[model samples]
Target: MQSATSPLQTLLDLINETLSLILRTSLTVRSFAGRWQPLRTKLASLQTSVADISDSPHWAENPLLYTLLPNLLSTLQRLKALADQCNDTSFTGGKLHMQSDLDMAAASLTNQLRDLDLLLRSGVLHQSNAIVLSHPGPGSDKENLSFFIRDLFTRLQIGGVEFKKKALESLLQLLEDDDKAATLVAKEGNVAYLIHLLDFHNQPWVREQAASAVSLLAASNDESRKAVFEEGGLGPLLRLLESGTTTLKEKAAIAVEALTADPENAWAVSAYGGVSVLIESIRSGTPATQTHSVGAIRNVADVEEIKAALGEEGAVPVLLQLLLSGTITAQEKSANCLAILASTDEYFRALIIQERGLQRLMHLIQDLLSSETLEHVLRAIASLSASEPCARVLSSSTLFLIQLAEFIKQGNSILQQISVSLLSNLSISISDGNKRAISSCMGSLVKLMESPKPVGLQESASQALVSLLTVRSNRKELVRDEKSVMRLIQMLDPRNEAVSHKFPVMLISAILAGGSQGCRKRLAVAGAHPHLQKLAEMEVAGAKKALQRLSGNRLKTIFSLTWRE
Candidate 1:
């Protein structure tokens, strides 16, 4: 056991002594020149490898290099002894026996050379050159951190099970907050190695850490996500979800979710039969696992084929259960998944209603404080509202209608848009009673139509008003609010290109269909007639129809008479 202070020096001294002994033996015993020749060549190569290692200031700190040094020294000592035997003139052993001993010595030298070459090629020594033992502070040298990450990758490639596990744990720490390092790992193609460890047999802990590392990398950036998918990460991740421990399943679900976030990688999840496993995870996994699994399903369900697969795999029931009982994240994710499914297929929408998914969603919406969860819940309800039967059922809930009206007025822009769209859908089947109740949202809808940006929100608000105004009571609600009616007429102005002329024209037509003279006179006085004439000339839909209805009240005579006045 040489002191670490001079281990390289000691190894170098042993190599020189061996080389000197080999020269003496080669000159003394010309009979074994063939064997000595190759042995000398091997020792020279090993010497060069040692010199390379010595060039790295941190080679002494490399655990693999330090461990190999003592064995290398011992091999040299044995070779020197064998060389001394070959130089002995009065040896009792015959020439043939001496030849065998020389051959054995040559073989030992070849093994040492091979070991040293492997050490150099492992890149461990070079990577150790950049090792920074202390935790990096703010604005530390990112290059050093990059080299340290590469060193861990080298260990993963060649170290034993324990070393690989420690490297994975270290990698997870590095990736925890350092997205740049994760990008580096992906660019270096090390994510494939991490994916390989996910299937490490009989080493659940190793696989756990590997899964965690992959999950972190997948979530880090688009590059890492694409890397994981390209490396076939989804297959092993699915297997973990199928049979791994609770913790492993949770980590694997997270990896799957992140990997599928890139829609390009989503089809592979279903290709690997992940849909059923993820649905089952929602049924039986831990709260965290359920959340991640639901999120993964939501990401993949965007693909039409995956949506059908989720339906066939009976995800609706499990997701509805999760929507009711899982964690807030799980509930949000489940609602989101359900939204995708219900939005795409009419059968899934009906299936969700049959499963009482609507009831659960309506119940969940009441207590949800997270805007994200509420958004998904509203999205789910909005999708279900597209079904006439589901609309009738949803409209029957007074509490639900009140909540929607409030969401229209008070929710964020996205929530406001979704709520408006839901009301628009509900208006098709809404009973006469519900229509009057939902009309309370008309003021907010009119206000939404006034904003110039997010033209889609404005369109959705106007479209809902058109549907609601088909009911006489809703028409009265609009007619009673002069500002609301005036805003619709203002939108009809061709110079106000912020909104299409069609929506405002449609709203006025729905109003005039009630045949209220006061509404017609109000429109005549508000100068709606000229706006409609210009819109009709432009051939905007519904503008001609609104003009005809407004003219039917002899508003043509009123307009001409007012012009003369």
Candidate 2:
């Protein structure tokens, strides 16, 4: 038992002992003596000790410790630092001390000590019997805290609406940053109590606060989310989505978003008619509501049924419109939601393209939007690029290709990945115009193929290179580059099992297809033959073809030499 309480006990003893010393000392104005200097030093040490207590790992499990310890520690440190500064000018028995300095030290010390006295006397150390006290109870020990919780629960049920509202508000305020409180709330079955208030409370303010509290509790905690769902919280939240005041709607939407973060809860929400409610909110809710509603849809978009339902409920057009003219946050959310939906079904992808979604996305990218907003826009384009028709449309645009290549060169890793993926997909069918655009940016493509880039980016770049080499015009441009042979050889690492490995080998084969003896010699000197032999042993067709290309010239040279002899 002593071991369990050691950390808290040590902190309490330190604080109380320091406070007692300050109280017992003679803090006279301009009193610089041996005792005064040592006392200030001790106080400074205590301040440092208290700061360390707040960062301890054990406090995470004890909500009372986690929440109240930091507050107490901060106040103690502030008082100690202030007192140290005030005590800097001291009086000696035979030395002259400024009267103003003495007075100032006296005033500051007096005020700080009074504040310290109030802090200790606030009953923060007395956590037991919290239910009877008007002050918020301490949470250091959970074993005895249940008594207070049970009593609070009983009173919450028997109290009037106003009292219940205030009690719930107090509970939420107390539990805000403390996971111990959150666990106790769920363990003691108080989640249902909060939901009841949200469902039937007479005051709009009460319901809003209740929803907000539930949102916080359920945000990342699976147990609380499940409890909220099983206790029938979804229906009231859905109704709130449709008809509540904007603030209430916002809180309830957040709660709904939290609950639906889990797929089971998302299915339950849709079963209770949440899809239509969310769609309606997106169509007509305030900018805030629409923003959160789109976020909620993004969470559930991975489920096939939910994706289809959202698409059928006229969500695609509404979301595209939001992407066009809504607030920046709304635009980001709408783009992400559309990206996920388009990824699920080709029909949805086609609809987005038909609605001119691609044009809006291109505009967002070209306008140099925020990195966050651009991330979603680029993701949407990447998803839509999966469709061949969409690919052709994107490849047809010279400006889009330029912007995409620039993004790959200048954007962060995420942008590089999506842009590379989109370009690779577009490379599935390279037209003459597409070939020209890609060849124009061959330097960036070569940069992407280097060692330090992510494997996905490297693989995608290889795919684009493969498509470019297919065009005879593009091949002439690529063969002249000095890094071309070495880059192709780099992709044949034996550890890479992805079919993307075949691209570079096939590209080399194409380069050697109609080349002079010099080109084959360049590839063989780049050590392509050994890697090709290894790959051909594994029965890779491209490796086999590339090997044949490298040796075809050598065999002809030998036969011609024999014929001349």
Candidate 3:
């Protein structure tokens, strides 16, 4: 019996002999001279590839080389026979048939050249050498580990289904908590190969592992995320999300979320019809899958053009359901997606309301403990509050108002800002009754306005106060709190450049319009005149109105007489 080494040696000898025969026969061919030269060149190239393979010490161990060698030897033998036939001057074969044979032989040689080139470029021979020579374990040194990683990538390029599967599994293990390795893989341009395995023709387990590897690399850093998207990873990822097993869907969803985190990539997701597949994943996937799917939806919904597609693809209803029933992470993502959709367009806000999203969100707010989730829930409610009907429903919920007040009082700056905006929205167009009820948050709103930093929170608080102060009770609450009232007046000072003078000026105008003579005297005592005078000169909105209100008709006449001096 011939050994494995014997087969490789025998194949090399046969290739050499056939090359010699082709060269000798080409000189004598009478017909198809044009085809013979190209065929001869291709055969010579094939001979060189086989010779190179024979020189490698581990070539016998390379399964690809072994599997390819026999077929290569067979092609060489057939070409040798074809060369002899073409060499016959009086060939009985029809001219067309002989020409056809030459074309087929040339095509076969070209295919063999391509296959050999792939094997040489694939580094499979090097991988086989590593397998035979080194037994690097999990605790190998950095150099060996890097070599191992490169080997795995080479296997991904050229290995069969089983080898590819093992390589993918090993890659996932290496990527865990190893940003350096992941970066190396990405820099080496292996991410595209991983994405290619997501094709449905690959075995389910292979696709799953590939998806897993992609998710790990994607989560590594910004560069890896860009690599995945730039390599055209989203299309196959969406396909995997659609048809893979539950675990595979979860993996694919994770990759999708990471890739779409950059808003620029969101357009690609929409272009690939990923919005609908992601919506389905949210609708039917497990808790983890739902979490990732909604997270992706949130990221993609950042694009203004894609929001309508999200709603058109039925994202709202599933997101609402996920918000109600998914895990905490899933709920946070769902609420965030809904918030984005509702904030962008009135149609989505109305659709969410039509789907009973408001009650579900309020329900989430009541029992939720995650400040993150609460922030998103507040954002959605704030968006919904833009609609007067939605505002009325929210304002009527005493519990909801109290929650907003609590968040304003105790939540982080982000929550405080969002809660204040929601309060402002809810106060619009509502009755004095609802205003009075919502004004229970008066103290917290004043405190927020008093905060010196994060001018946004101060702006939101001042804006909310303007909306709330339309009620008699709210104005009285502001008027009676000397310090809070002074804070509003101080914010109007032209020297306080960080604060927008408009909202504070409007709040003070509302205050002086409703307060008594005592309040007007207190304003003059607080040095309101010079600030309003400077703001009026600067053409700040409502500055002249508040100045006029503060001076009153008698003070105006007295100031005019003094100016005439």
Candidate 4:
């Protein structure tokens, strides 16, 4: 006969076995051939069962464990069966259709395991309900965590420095792993409490923790973020960034980043003299600090007034420095900010070019980085290329020209559009070398126009084509390609009368300007004449001219006839 175990010991044994099953099931399902939708449903159901058991009013009582253990065991049995089915080789069809669902299921199972482990290991379940309300460790019950936070919120104003610091630290921790808990903390008025702490707390660690907490809490909920700005969080945050220690400055920058996520917060940031403080942080703080500072600036730089303020405060020189020397993240942020600033103001664009930023950007593109980083680099370059001096520099660089063409063919859609726009600028006052490079890529441009890309891209691509057609040789090359005339005809959609009526219409006129009979016949056969005539009725000069050119070719052919009359 076997001896029966104590109730606590039996419950602990059940928890350990349940955790083992979860881990083993996760592994088996992960290695299965079929998609894990079946496994995901099983795990989610198991997690829900555990949550329901935990949420029961009698959950904290030891006697209830005996009652709940059978339900948990039943769930575990079903989960194991489902896991076995997932691993069954006899199942058919695609093997990885629901990878995302499988991933989410795994995470859910892991969280449940942690919660159960916490429930068993904490050893706090007594007949009496007088457990100590201390800071929560992993998998602490939500009720306990919320109670602990409520207690701390009461102490935040009147507590000693050490107590206040501890409260802020605990609050920051609770917010990190659980958004629901973060919401509770914010709803308890802890955000307002922390903002006050950031302003008046004498201890550096307290302010740092407070700033850190504010950042997370503000970002967690829309209401919390709005509350932070409404409660005057910007001034304290800016002051922290201005004079606090490096760690405090880093934390303050985080809060500022979150605050600026709302466009309305930008004004508060600038009004509180954050422009100067953020620039200083970027210049002097560590790399992480620089990244956050630049993020804050990027959020605000879109506002023209703030942009001029940053420029007035000499942000350009320091931003250029960061672009050259900072970490990869910092360089990315710096490039993004410079792109916006330069795009908004021509003076800033010229300044960036003179500071050798353009040359660095060219090199960055050639480094073959990710598309995201390359997009920012190209954006700044595109803006710079619009300036005559910068255009000359970019056009003169064979490397830059080649990279732009490569981007057009292989980059994402936005990158392709930007590349074509820059090419258009380069083609203006284009040197013969630049024209040759661009003309070599005429096929790529025509393909872009034919793609189902956005109308803006088609417009830009057509503009670049128009500029390239300025060269007589390029115009002849366009007519020689069969797809070019068809593509031009496709662009003459009455629905898109804006770009269709303008740039594509101009392109057809230029191709016909070469007066090739074959090109004219191709356009007519492609049914361009009707669309062109429609444009001519609308008083589009280019359309009228193209129709006239095509009509002249027809008249010439008739006059050359030797028919009997």
Ranking by TM-score: 3, 1, 4, 2
Of candidates 2 and 1, the better by lDDT: 1
Worst-scoring 10-residue span by lDDT in model 2:
116-125
Candidate 4 matches the true fold with a TM-score of: 0.66
> On residues 469-552, what C-alpha lDDT tens digit does candidate 1 reach at each position?
878777766777888877877888999977777778878888898898887888878889999999999999888888999988
Per-residue lDDT tens digits of candidate 3, residues 1-565? 2434477777777778878887888878877788888887887787788777766655667655565677777877887787788777767899898888878877877877876776666455655465532334656677666666666776666556766767777787778846577776777546877888788444777777788888887777888888888888889888889988888888888889998888777788878888889888888898888889889888878686678787678888888888878998998888888888888888898899999888888888889558888888888888888777787788788778777877877888889888887776666655677677666677678767766676567777877787788777778776777777677677878888666778778777877777467667777777788889899999999899888888895486799999999
User: Which candidate model has the greater lDDT, 1 or 4?
Assistant: 1
Stretches off by above 4 angstroms in model 1 are: 1-5, 11-51, 54-58, 71-132, 155-170, 187-193, 201-208, 304-309, 385-388, 395-398, 451-463, 470-474, 529-565
Listed in order, each prediction's TM-score against the native is 0.76, 0.66, 0.77, 0.66
- Model 1 poorest 10 in a row by lDDT: 128-137
Model 3 root mean square deviation, Cα atoms: 6.0
Cα lDDT tens digits, model 2, 1-565, are 5534766666666666655545444364244454356545545544544444333433323323433444455555554444454455652333333334444544554444443333223232234344242423564577544444444454455445655666666667656756666666666636777788777878777788788877776664788777777888888888888888888788777778788888776777567778889989988888878888888887888777787788779888889888877778888888888887777788888888888888888887877467778888888888887777777888888788878877777778788778877878887665767677657556556667664456577778777766766766666676566676566677676665443566667677777776657678777777877888888898876788788888887789889999999
Sort the candidates on lDDT, descending order: 1, 3, 4, 2
Give residue 35's lDDT in candidate 4 (0 to 100). 42
Tally clashes: model 1.
Answer: 0
Runs with alpha carbons beyond 4 Å of true place in candidate 3 = 1-11, 26-38, 54-71, 81-112, 122-129, 132-149, 200-202, 302-305, 428-440, 452-456, 466-565
Give the top-scoring candidate (lDDT).
1
